[model samples]
Target: MIPDPTVRLIGWAVTRTAEAIVDRAADRIATKMKTCIVMTVRHRAVAALPKRGRV
Candidate 1:
């Protein structure tokens, strides 16, 4: 059986690594979402504007 200290050390390392990866991924996803939302809003606003000098 593995020693208690060794197991604790492994668990701690794994937890820290996972947390780091998740944090990085969350930041990237948030950035992309914000960009997409802003672009979509701008596009809709421009499209909704009335046409000028048209029959």
Candidate 2:
């Protein structure tokens, strides 16, 4: 399903914030582990794209 612009934007912010937290936590645990966390953020940002394209 596709989210509206507002919804998608909100989701984008939420997802980004969550990813940042996760990435920071990972860095705290192990500095070298940040690459995986960053990759995960990239994956999620891509996944959040509306399947039907933008409104």
Candidate 3:
């Protein structure tokens, strides 16, 4: 049986909204992970540098 036009439109809108929300959340997570990785790398590199003073 075919559903009402209004109901179908609402369902489609909800689906699209959910997808957009998910996409935004994933992007945020990826950005945070990237920042963490970069920070860790920088910290390790700094630690590896030779200390000043004392020959």
Candidate 4:
């Protein structure tokens, strides 16, 4: 069977495009997770701190 270079190139491009989309989604998810974690930690810390004494 004769291999067609154009078909192979097209397949590679499609695969790379799919991979880029997946990578972007993963990055967004990771960023959201990190933001949530940071917010939760800050809330907990603030809640745990003692009230400031009057001057």
Quantify all predictions' global Cα lDDT against the true fold.
Answer: 0.99, 0.88, 0.97, 0.97
In the range 1-55, model 3's lDDT, one tens digit per residue, is 6679989999999999999999999999999999999999999999999989977
Off by over 4 Å in 1: none
What order do you get sorting by TM-score, best first?
4, 3, 1, 2
lDDT per residue (tens digit) for residues 1-55 in model 1: 9999999999999999999999999999999999999999999999999978868
Per-residue lDDT over 3-43 for candidate 4, one digit per residue giving the tens place of the 0 to 100 score:
79988998999999999999999999999999999999999
Residue pairs whose backbone atoms clash in candidate 2: none
The sequence of per-residue lDDT tens digits that candidate 2 reaches over residues 1-55 is: 5669988899999999999999998777785567778989999999999788578
TM-score of 2: 0.49
- Evaluated at residue 12, the lDDT of candidate 3 is 96
Q: Pick the candidate with the highest TM-score.
A: 4
Clash counts for the predictions, in order: 0, 0, 0, 0
Candidate 2, residue 34: Cα displacement in angstroms equals 13
lDDT (Cα, 0-100) at 40 in candidate 4: 100
- Ranked by lDDT from best down, the candidates are 1, 3, 4, 2
> How accurate locally is residue 45 in candidate 1, as Cα lDDT from 0 to 100?
98
Q: List candidate 2 segments past 4 Å from native.
A: 1-3, 31-55
Candidate 4 residue pairs in clash (backbone atoms < 3 Å): none
Worst 10 residues of 2 by lDDT: 27-36
Q: Against the hidden reference, what TM-scores do the models get?
A: 0.72, 0.49, 0.82, 0.86
- Select the stronger candidate by lDDT from 1 and 3: 1
> Which residue segments of model 4 deviate by more than 4 Å?
1-3, 53-55
